[model samples]
Target: MTITTDKFNTEKAPKPVGLYPHARKVGNLLFLSGVGPRQAGTTKIPGVDLDEHGKIASYDIEAQCRSVFDNVRTILEASGASWMDLVDVTVFLTNMDDDFAIYNKVYAEYFADNQPCRTTVEINKLPTPIAIELKCIAALSE
Candidate 1:
């Protein structure tokens, strides 16, 4: 069998900050780029508290996690997939110690039944002030 790849873009989710599609489908595997809490066509990020100069003041991990998952769901649906199709997910957090519990709680609300394998890591920063981001992979329907 020959493997084919296709790129996906959707206005239903936040536009990619860099030059990349929201997802790329290679055969049955749909690989999604990192999704954050930013809204489409706006600088606003859910759960993020920004200073007057746009520095991160504080954040709500539950809100950020929910928004990130929502964005991921949009992209997945746009690519003809669903939450149940997700096979793996990688989570990024600016503060694991402060955020993991809330983030995990929010995550369970969405994926407890269709739980995908997940890996979460703490990072110093993200491109925006949001506390969370998610990159995922889904198995496309045959």
Candidate 2:
């Protein structure tokens, strides 16, 4: 069978920083790109304060995680999916040790019932100052 794909974008989510769409659908699966905390059409990142040199001066992991998940939700909805439809999520964090607990708490509030399979890992840096990002996939509703 030939597979067809479609790119998904929405104004409710932050504009992609590079040459990629927010998500893509191939048949029933929606694959989302890394979703971050930056607000749509603005440079503001919810959980981060930047220094003069654009470094993270202070950060709140919970805020960042919430924003990222909200952004992901936007894309998912735009792609005809929902949080409950999500089957897998891959999370990236710059400081996992210090941030995991808060992130997990906020995450539980969203996914406690639907509880998708998840994998989280520490990374050196992301494209922005935000502390967390999520790459997710969902099975599209029939």
TM-score of each: 0.95, 0.97
Task: Count clashing pairs, candidate 2.
Answer: 0
Per-residue accuracy of model 2 over 1-142 as CA lDDT, tens digit each:
9999999999999999999999999999999999998999999999788999999999988888888888998899888888889999999999988998988899989998898999999999998887888999899865
Candidate-wise lDDT, in order: 0.89, 0.91
Instruction: Give the clashing pairs for model 2.
Output: none
Worst 10 residues of 2 by lDDT: 133-142
lDDT of 2 at 135: 92
TM-score of 2: 0.97
Reference-based lDDT, residue 87, model 1:
99
